[model samples]
Target: MPTTLRRSLLAVLATAFLGAAPSMAMAGVNPPTVDDNLDPGSSIHVTKTVSTPVIPPRPDVVLVVDSTGSMGPAIANVQSQLSTIVSSVKAAQADAQFAVADYKDVSDGASVFTVRSDLTGDPAAAQAAINAISAGGGGDGPEAQLNALWQIGAGGNRISFRPGSSRVVVWFGDASGHDPSLGHTLADAVTSLQGVSAKVVAINVAGGDGLNATGQATAVTSATGGQFFPSVAAGNLSQAILEGLTNLPVTVTAETACDPGLSVSFSLSLPRTVQSGSDLVLEETISVAPDARQGSTLTCTTRFKLNGADAGDEFVQRVAIGVNDVTPPTVACGPGVNPSGRTPGGWQQAGFFQMVADDNLAGVSVAIRDDATGTSFGPYAPGTYFKLTQAPGRSGSTAVPFTGAVDWHFGFRGDATLVATDAAGNTASATCSVPPAQK
Candidate 1:
């Protein structure tokens, strides 16, 4: 058979074997037989007991509703679903807290009324307040969505909660309330709600308006790192709100621990992936919990493979690891300056050198030098300014090389060194020449 056909058949056979392996294993093991005959009233009844895991407290939630006349249907629907909403919240978080805010006539003296304070672990009160909210007024002018959003997000009326508690803010509106025409941005509103780190969800209910309320809602949601539910009607409003609130935020923490010195081995557990690149991506936060050390140097040496073969010969990249408090080492290189030869009278010789270095904590430093006679030439900082001199070499005596094409037995040296001393004092060094200035 052809190579492609053979490979496909092998893959199919492997998949089939894998799919059947579990059933085959189970069939090989016989289950325990049960006794058919049992005593009647004389035998005691054995009950099967199950233990329930303790449920943690739920996150804090703030509901921002638009009470404009257009929201009557939505408000009524939300109130009707109050019981189910409260029950779902309670089921998910035994100690969840909830707050409600309503915005009316938002443009002119936009009214923001807080119907309830944070009702912690009190689902009954939250439901009562939800039932009490009435949608009225505020239909002619624009909805003061920016002001309402700002108040809930960063405004003084924002809800407060303990660390690790999820903070959620749901905004219900229709039509772009803020003035998108005059660049009345949501940035101010987004900036205001920074402290609580609240996730803002905007549910736009405006119908037949070309104002792009959905787009505006999405912008506000993305700004606060929240989700957007657009053009949802009153009937589906409660369900959408619950869906957005029920999602638990994924928390991640990263740590690194490894063997002490050269050839060090370390593992990291971050609450989430720290970096992503073309070759490899972090699947999840590396968790080194008990095994990994904190505030220590972790040297990671990953091997790249292509088709199960080492591809390190193709390309190699370095990844640096450092802790919060300590300052990491820096890399520095020597300059590449050309040496001076005899120039005819009234002629001057100019040489150029370049160096490169980098550091995670302390920064970088570079120095240039001439290798011919062990003498120090220059330690100029490496940058675009380090270019070859425009002057020609005395009309023919090896014409002082133009631009970057200068020759004079040069060596580029660099070292990874820092001011702060680390536990392992890990460092790196490299050296290379300018490849003999092209003939």
Candidate 2:
């Protein structure tokens, strides 16, 4: 029998025996467990569905600008275009908030890095902060922008990012950042960005040895799952900020962890985009290895993420699988009754019958039922089965007595059913008939 066919049979048997089979009762995952019997070299597919929570477009944007003499043009651009940029972002994400921060060289003392404005919904305050930035003085080629990123990303609510809002840092600079700024390494800065779930859209101003020229911009953006715009003109700083806020892509991915004998696959390719406030459907196929041991259990757990961050409780699924056997045992019995035999009490006419049984998988047992007498005998399993028939014995007084074994013989039999069963409960049967004793 095929694995699937056997599973069907088991289901029918379960319903017949237990009133009703239990439902797949589980929370968060539909059909919590995959309880099926799968034979070797066979497979089954499963589907998993998860309802993505609705996430409205709420953006918490922070503008980190280079405040060095060389960045005069970029600062001027932000002052001139702040209102337009805010309007554009608001058009897409109505709940967008903005903040402003600036950084100069270490020698600039208190001006090395400054939070010009905390995150706010008021465009005027954001605009005022940008307009007040005076670009000047620096003692080194590299600036303290790296330090600024670390502070904003890991500075303990320094920028005050709103809850459940998309965190973005629009960083525009004309110089590469110092490797170790204020005792924090580049890696430390990147970790900070990830810690706060902040994406840095780095806009490299001017073509010369700037942020991109040293690969700092690329590293920061890539590490934070953000974007990097290279060789952007200082005048287009505002455009970069607008695009960074409005055009950023949101990707959906599932992190699946499964047991050894089982493997899982999805209907849709991973790392795909899922729009905000939209539902995401994931169809997964679960399969067991052909060589897996029968009756072994398989399992898998998957958690969905949105843009490199966990999508929370509503987006999790778990699966459990079971392997089963399908093939039934085979049995053969005598076509006619055996010779009559005498016991200590009397002559047993229809006593013994020849029988043999075998199973493809092992652990074969037998059951015999005398239809005429309505008497049933057992499920004679392995060790006990072979011990059913004992040596024939006779009474001393009776000469040449025809002795027969106990249990194996029947007092009277017309037709009997012989059933052979295997360890998996699969069975096969044959009938043996006893015609009226020799007449």
Candidate 3:
């Protein structure tokens, strides 16, 4: 089977499972004590929420191509298609910036070569660089992919977008150079690149049997939330790159109410207008009052209207709703001293952290992470908080306790973010930071 066909099948299977599953219940699970749910207060008492489509920000791209003796034909093909790729990307997103890096053997070693430092919106420069590359190097040593990835991740001259732009590193190679042990080095480089919100896309040009190619692409892409195109050739490389650039769906959860018969509606706001061929999936939950029907069918439809045109904007999707009999859980957190400064024992000593996320239909789970180390902590134990009588006056709050004499010397150097996920995998996160202790 073709690689694209396999991916398509997998996606279809996943979607089929999601649709066939029973409508998730939001009640019975305990509500958090602090009412920390990020969405506006819920009245229908939905247990879970999840999103179907997620569009990411504009990306900065770095094109890394292999320039080996055997790659003469492939290299030439890539050079010819360079203009088309740039134009397509620009058409999709105007802010996209690009850079080129070609690797060939220099006097010092095989992997060493020249890198153009300037990044631009100009397609001419990219094309020029592509045309200038020569594929004649003696040492057939594997391409220095690890080193190149590291350099790109470290924000070398190849990637030059301003801060905050999404960064994407696209690596193209024809043969296996280094062993999988280089994965650690690749991962570290990717990690640094991610610090700037950049991801790595590996496109292996190795044809014939795709044994090592697939594995290499997977290693790099998995580490950076990017994609791997194994066995891709110069002919299909541009398309592969574009497909990889498209953002995947993001999960979102909102709280709203609906009567047994009345249709409840919600709208998804996009960061920008949706492109013509692009489509979005709308995932939702309609929770009924406690004494409502158990096996009712809830209908859902997605409408895309321009300027409030009812005719053009309406598209419908439906699902069967199932009732959950279990009682909702309650959530709670800290009665102890708040960590004013960095706790001497790091995050482990933050005390018993707890929160209750309840849904009359679906229920919820919460996760916490330390922003400084990018370390994730937990789905803290439940039942330490109180349920809202009628949607508490405020959102939610959670407390982290600091024990012993506060070490003013090592104050909080980073942020701790808390995220709550419902049964539907809908999530909301809140960030709190301990101020740096006085010197």
Candidate 4:
């Protein structure tokens, strides 16, 4: 984006980006991130990654807790912030499904170590469950955190993660958790979590457990490839948990490709970092050379950290450009006799032109060419040819006043060629030959 952007080579993207509006935002973005040294004769193939995982418009999240007596403040905080938190999460993931599973140490002996709520799309329902949870338990230092993880993380069927959904497990509490005693070790917890590929985001509420509690949470998350939050070691437990859930990581990629002679830019006006559920567009521009052939096709592709990342499924855009000038322009001529402005046929020499959007006709450009002698001339002068007024069919007519006769120079012939080209690389050409010999 901070490179020398050459504008002329990107004619193709002007139209293609407009056509692919659904897939991306029209922001300034560079597909290759850098574009100055690209080869002009080569096909363009640049990819730009978004770098942040788009928040799943609706993600499936399960809150597994270490609900013990000290958990009162943590659970209450969750209740107070539940609405705002869900609202914020829903802003990015409108269809976010939230469920809860509260667990105390198995040593707590039958006091509701594991309580599961079915996933619900309604934020209100999720908030209600969060508000209803109570922090009450008496046991050893460790809680049945892993067993709770086992039930849901192992796809225990009590909670179902939707298909094509991001799997997240958020757990918070004020104390440490035990690895064994529930008939399963820490490895068992890791294996269960692997079943669903759920990232276990652990929150050591209020720094109460000191190192041991955070250690257990860290071990589980590390085994599962989930991330551990900042080392601030303390904060509002509710804020910490929400931040872990909503501010997820991501990988983004954008690719802009084209045929030779066409320049493609993937990040014309695109953001380097995009948050989840943002309706932003990654703009791409493709320009073609003046001499590029007509009827050519072009493409743009973008891949993300997760496949199928485009909000509207607009991962790629392709189009065919039409070229003008398939045939030479037609030129009609009759030279005047003896250069006296008098034709033997009594008709003045002239040229006629037509093009698309006939009513919007602009005068055409023509230079004289002698086929036999290989010479070309003019940008003819005003009185040499006059444009027609209110012409028919987007047309223009002009008279060429020259020579006294059609064959003034005894068999000399002047073939006039007319060429017309349009904005989309379409060109038309025609040649009219003045007959040789006297007419």
Candidate 5:
């Protein structure tokens, strides 16, 4: 099979084993598992990639309806479908919350813009507030829409939105808002909405000079990071609300945390904003401290956020690091000295020489190998290893060539290598040469 097709099939099979469809975005760390025999004072890097979801979740929606005389049917429709809308949003995001508010003309009474309910997770409370709204008095062609928005958005968060949530105002009406409604102009409304991070989904109902009758809906929605749906039927308001929430624009960013022994740095100057569903690649350099003990493990996690809200564990990537020792022990062999004399059996007597081995972490053994004779000698421990013993008057001046060792004649005729091994299996060697009995 082709490489791409095979990978796709593997992904499908893996998702199937998990008993779920691939409906949500996921994040991953490249080379997820790191096992290395690294020397002390060394480091490595890991790549973490995070992708944003298609929808911004944890919506905090506020229904800002125009409760004018002509808006009875629209108000009633929303009240009836409030439960369904809540269920749909909760299905997409379990932490969704809702609120209710309405606006009428200032000329009618002192209750021009009233917040019926604060933002809450209780759908029943929001529905009760919407049900209590009686569309009765709205004088003239325009209502106090701008005033209502100002109160909800810039009026000190009159709706009490959750910090880190996607703020939305589902506003609908059949009439345009009064310019400078209750001392607040269109520009003031837009600025206030943006300040509170609120996105307006303006649904202009049909059968009258709508909210966009004078194009104010278009201006407000565009300037506040929202959408404008003109001439929508009063009955189809619920579906439009659902569509608005799903299609809402969101910003993505990344954050990282690591264990004490490990330090991490990223390639991107976070929190860098990215579009929804876009791939964000971050090169994370994970370094183990130079003084970190061998045979230890380090870990780090990279998490994602959507519009400043935590995107949960599904959008997190974790890395595990293993540290091992790779430094070899040091080995040195003393110079050769000629044999003192020959034995009666015509065998050369043993000469003295020393082999020293040192390791950074201790616990080392020393061994010797005769290159010319292909013979091996003792793998002696620290104190038991051979050492040079000078005869009387045979000081450093008369230290001639030697036939070394007792059993296998190491460095007997040619050169020999002294090897040292540490407890971690790291090895080092040094050569020792003996002249052939000085001719």
Candidate 6:
């Protein structure tokens, strides 16, 4: 299974389970503390989504032909259709170029290594150079393959490659290389290739009857983040090369959310985008608010775009996080027993909204507010003096405590506000008024 698919599954499962089971109920919502089966509070959800796209790149191809005694058939096939390959690539990238390099054995004299033609955008020139190469003069099972790569890679870009272009070296061969015994070692080739940011895709067609096809080509390809085809024929080589050149990578560019309580961090090791033919894991971490309600989902989104892709070519990921909320209590007001005229204070009942508002209870806060002393529960605005006092209530009943003073009087036609607040910042308010004195 792909890593992306697995991550997606986990995210879906989390949402699925939350909707199905009561085990994921809001945290800290104790049922015994409220009047009726009540709910916690509202919470936020964050979701993220990822996107992938394929964008082709301008190609710089160095067709490394294995010009040895055993590679005549493949070389001829390549040389014959060389112009067609250039024509195909030019359709995608007008600036695409084709270069030529032929490799022989160390014993093949000065003809052992030759760059018949450097990089050129002209199809006719590339075909002529391929036609000029003739296969022969190779001894032993292994040839100077690494030496050929080292020479071409170490050479200046003017003669070998184009600067500011994607580098590719397609090495077609029948047998393995003579390790590092030639002019340069495999390590030297790797260094040169890395320095030029080039990849060598090796196609080995030599492991026939008696030839012990060594894996030097495959190793070098892997080292340079390229690919190896064990027995790819010459006819299919053009398609393979084209596919590798055009493959693309997309990456996360930005993320934003409405809630100020969430924080996100991207992976440090993995590149934001997936590389062609490579398995990459996109990682990120999102932290929830300290007072986030349990079982609440926090959603976040991420936007992605391909490297130099076409305009409006982008993708997105929606990520969801669940949490719990801290809920507040509920309160109500009633008439006071104080004598009329002088002053009158009201009695207010308060209950914690743990499970159900009125029935369940543990601790509930009640605020007695005048027109001036504005309460946080938002029943009254600030303007007057205030004090906290416990109200009469059935101990261990649904109601917890209420704030008020018997001496806190309201003049005739006077009014006060009863404010109720719970742990999770939830609030409720009630108005208590005194009738005019025999108006």
Question: Which candidate number would show the highest TM-score if scored against the true structure?
Answer: 5
lDDT of 1 by residue, 11-104 (tens): 4323332242111110000111111211111111212111111111245677888777677888887887755665555553445677877776
Taking all chains together, each candidate's TM-score versus the true structure is 0.45, 0.50, 0.45, 0.57, 0.72, 0.48
> By summed lDDT, which 10 consecutive residues of candidate 1 come out lowest?
21-30
- Writing each residue's lDDT as its tens digit, candidate 5 over 148-214 gives 9988986646878887888888888999888898889988888889988888899988977889977
**Deviation in Å, model 6, residue 37 alpha carbon:** 36
Residue lDDT tens for model 4, 314-392: 3334433332223233333323233443333422232222111211123444444444444455544212332111222
User: Residue 438: error of model 3 in Å?
Assistant: 83
State the lDDT of candidate 3 residue by residue for 23-132, as single tens digits.
21111111111111112212232332221211133446778776767677777776766676666566545566788886653332734645663467788987887787
Better of 2 and 4 by TM-score: 4
Which ten-residue region of model 6 has the weakest summed lDDT? 25-34
As a whole number from 0 to 100, the lDDT of residue 195 in candidate 6 is: 73
Candidates' C-alpha lDDT: 0.45, 0.66, 0.48, 0.51, 0.69, 0.53
Candidate 4: C-alpha lDDT: 0.51
Judge candidate 6 at residue 202 and give its lDDT.
74
- Candidate 4 least-lDDT 10 residues: 1-10
Model 3, residue 307: displacement in angstroms? 27
Which candidate has the highest lDDT of all? 5
